[model samples]
Target chain A: MKKPIRLINLGKTESWKTQAVYHALAEEMTDESPDTIIICQPDSPYLCLGYFQPFDSIFDRKNVELLNLPVYRRRIGGGATYLDENQLFYQFIFHHSRVPVALEKAYKTMLAAPVETLKSCGLDCNLRAVNEIEVNGKRVAGIGGGRINDAAVVVGNFLFDFDFEAMSTVWKAPWPGFRELAKDAVKERVYTLKQCAPNLRMRAVSDKLIELFPKYFNRPIVSGSLSQKEIMASQKTAQVLTDKIFLNDGNTDIPVQPRPLKISADVFIHNKKMFFKNKKINVSFRTDNDVITRVKVEGAVEIEKTIIGITIEEIEHILNSGSSTVLKDN
Target chain B: MSKKDYNFPADLHYDGKNHMWVKKENDNIVLVGIDAIGLDTLGDLAYITLKPEGTIVKKGEPIGTLEAAKMTGDIFAPVSGKISAVNAACVENPGIVNDDHYGKGWMVAIDASDWSTESTALISGEKLQPWIEAETHRMETQGFDA
Candidate 1:
């Protein structure tokens, strides 16, 4: 027998309302409560950061303060993104035991509805990676989730329109020159629905999703509204989300230590984190003009400017050799 | 243990519905952790946040939140108690839950405030065997095994 699901279409709401309501609904979930699907769009612009992401690591606090742009952190795991009214948000909240237990399989199953909706619109989108949708090798949508009380929520978006400049302003590169390339990368990697259809309305896309979700999930969708308890809980959550202290909880000042900075536009440092014998080793290095420029090991020991002109592969080989295992990277 | 294996030691008391195992460490303290089936089914772990060290937790109350890649599950107390200590290693590296769930991944230890009353609600021995096997079979039918 098909299961029952409650559909809450919160058409257009304040930037925080979309996050607050779904979060509150998830918090109040119990075994007796029906599964839920929330669809909405933010009316204003805001930068939403991931739960584990440190603010200063991804965004410039001074620029955020100067621009007076609002920012909030979600209890979800993923990178930050600039969200506005153009992106239609869908959050699927259900009991953890009610869904597939495998992570990759679960995400693919839950996201199939949105993917099929975009496919019907002639976007040729497919669920790629574990948590993203791709069209012609470019990401069209992003998905992430976390647990709240007894519910597991998988949240995703339909990218109706994207603001590249606004996105670049919030996301910071490790250094200058790379920031411009990073912005260029965003334009190169992400695509929007309007890029395919000349005059597709956000409402039309949302309607398609609403129509298709029932067929994909094989559940009867009964339209519903927030309960009184959910409303009061969301109001309380909204207050907590907008609090300034909550936003700046992990803010830190950058040290003036002389670091090997990115000198060229093409040189990009990849922060690779590996777990060897339950110990985390983080390595940061970049090739400058086809030559290894600098190697820095952070978060374990102070080995700054200790090794240079050696390729990352050679460093890996030496590290793996297990003879001189003194420097552990960040 | 095999990916399809179901192993709930007979000595450990379980809140079967919630899928938690509680092992009495002393007269008043009990060590709690998610069972192998729960760990195997919950996908890879990303983060685990436990209730603060000294907070009083009620039986069946959530003591921590576990975030897998796409889904999140709660870790509940099997008995009413005050959290005496938390596993620092598991919080630092949550992968241990998948790698060694029964050993190093033990989540918390509670100083049972009312051990006798709360302990009565837990299941063990004969009752736990059928419950775990049925739950495992149900999960396997849903395509959860690695």
Candidate 2:
């Protein structure tokens, strides 16, 4: 006997509603409530912070305020992200007993539907690492999962388009050149469905997900609306999501030194401005699994070629030693 | 690590449901932390936050939250009590919990209000080994390595 899962297809919603709907469902879920899958798109843009990611450490508050972007703190763990209408959100809320206890296995199970859906849309994509989905080495989706009370929740999106500039500009860069470096790195590593499958319609993608998810999970789907209690819970959860204190909560005082912007499971951008020979030198580089894969140095061109194949520790040693041999004739 | 290799210290009382261990510091004070099996299943932790000192929490309520890369789970209270102290070091650097889960990773000290009644629900003494064996078996059945 297959258990029936509720399908709540909210076509387009207020920005907060997109996040709050799933959160409310998870918070109020009990053994009696049916497992649910929610698909929705936000009508506007908002900045979402991870559950444990401190706001001050991740975002440029002044720029965020100037842009008038609403900031929300979701209970899921992940890096802070810029969300807008260009992405379709899929949120799954299941009782803890229904999903795999191991986080890795849980992600593989939940992401199977989206991976298959993207493939049907004429894109070659698969789940990478624990949760991210990628096509030809470029990430095509944003994913996050966590436990909220007794409910195990997984949320992700299909990117129709993304504003790389907005994402980079809003981040609190440790160095002046960091934003541009981040933007270029992200643009290189992320992809949109429209860019890959230009002929595919968003509705077709949604319909395919609706049809395929129940089959993948072996659960019959019953299209339904939120119960009155769930509606009230969502309204209240929205207030908590946008609360200033909640946004500012967590360890905000941690110093931002070598802030590494994670581009993928193996790619990270480390930016810092080092002082040597009474001259301030801007340093930006990308690391693939702790080894320097690329290097950009503002003060010395020679150091770039020298440090490309070295580990971060080796470069730090060369830079910190104030070795005139490396910095000479700059 | 295999199920038999995971540590379940003999002195601590374990909450099989939440995978937390409680150590009775005194009659009213009990120190709490997640067990080895729980940490093994969670993977490397990145961040942690606990209820502030002096906050009263009910049994099974969230005392704090722990996050790995993109997955977060709550640390539920093993016994109802007022939080006497929170481990600030663990909050600052959560990796220590991965390194020394039973030692420096201890999450909170609770001034328990209902020790006698709540203590009975916790598994300890002769029952600890059997309960852990069952739990590890259950996790393995759910596609997780012990």
Candidate 3:
């Protein structure tokens, strides 16, 4: 007998609630609680950070605040991403024991529905290695999953449109040509529905997912609403999800490097010189227990004040900000 | 250790069912880790979450989770016991699960309350090689790069 899984469609919600809902379901679901698959879209754009990533290292805090873009940290592990209504989210919560114990097996098994759905659309999308759906060598979706309490939650996006400019603007990439690098990186990796077929409505793609999930998982898909218990739990979880303390958790400043360099644990250095877009930045620095300390920078005086600390994040910030204009004018 | 180019360290006891390994640390403690076949098949581990010390966990219940660049899954406790300690290095740098799974990649250690009875469930020595071979064949059938 196929297990019956509840399907909840939260049409559109404040961005943070999108993450909170699935997290709450994962925490509250039991063997008795109906297995669930949620479909929703964010009402506005928000930056969602990976579980272990530090906020300071991943985002230009000053730029994010200046732009008034809200940020939330999800309990799931992955890199930071910009989320908006242009994408549809599917969140699955199942009893942990019911899922495959092997991580890769679970992904290949659960992600079949979406892969099948994309194929139905006449695109040869493959669930590419390491958590992405690729079509003709370009990524079409981002997938990530992790266990939250007794339930294992897998979350992914069906992208109708992507804002490369907004994405490049928000990510912390401190260096000259970093924004272009960010944009190029996205173009190299991701493909939006608009890029594929502008006429395809997101609703049609979502409907395809709804139609195929039951068939692929060998489960009955029954339409349902959140019980009162889930609503209350989700509301409480949303509060914590939006809290600054939760957002700030695990974030630390990463030291800046102009060029890629490998420093082993055994090697120690007090001074070094590196180039940022061909400009020499002489560095004087010390380390305490491998953490950078007492840093100074000479050359590139236009951005020296912002990068004297010598963290990758700081240099990226200066480089990412208006550094290109400074470089051009210099 | 290098039969068929897959690591099945002879000293470690194998949980053929779950694909985890057990190392008897002392009279009361036993260390748990994912074997090399598991490490290679799962790809690089990006995040590791283990139950905090002093938590009582049952045999077969999940004691932690491992997230890789591609997927995420639970780490089941092989014995019913109290989690005495977890690998801090694995938590901070999860790649060790792939780079050095047997040594620095050990997940957690338990102060077993029922090791004498529970350990009989685990297989060691000649038993592990065959079990690992079976697992590799199973992974190849599933389209993994085993």
DockQ of each: 0.36, 0.44, 0.18
Better of 2 and 3 by lDDT: 2
Which stretches in model 3 have alpha-carbon errors above 4 Å?
A: A102-105, A250-330, B1-22, B27-30, B35-41, B47-66, B73-93, B107-146
In the range B1-146, model 2's lDDT, one tens digit per residue, is 46547798999999988999999996699999999888877888887878889999999998888887768889999999999999999988888899999999999999999999999999999999889888877766662111
| Candidate 2 chain A lowest-lDDT run of ten | A250-259
Compare the candidates by lDDT and give the number of the best one: 2
The residue-by-residue lDDT of candidate 2 on A1-330, one tens digit each, is: 667889999988889889999999999888788999999999999999888766777899999998889999899887788999999999999988788777788888888899999888767788888888998768998898998998999999989999888898899876656676678878888898878887777788889998998768877889999889899999999999898877876343222223467776777888766555567787788888899877777767676786688897887677577666333211
- A best-first ranking of the candidates according to their lDDT comes to 2, 1, 3
How much of the true A–B contact set does each candidate keep?
A: 0.30, 0.56, 0.21
lDDT of 1 by residue, A62-82 (tens): 777766778876766666778
DockQ of 1: 0.36
| Positional deviation of residue A312's Cα in model 3 after best superposition, in angstroms | 18
Best by TM-score: 2
Quick one: how many clashes does candidate 3 have? 7
Docking class of 1: acceptable
Better of 1 and 3 by TM-score: 1
| TM-score-better candidate, 1 vs 2 | 2
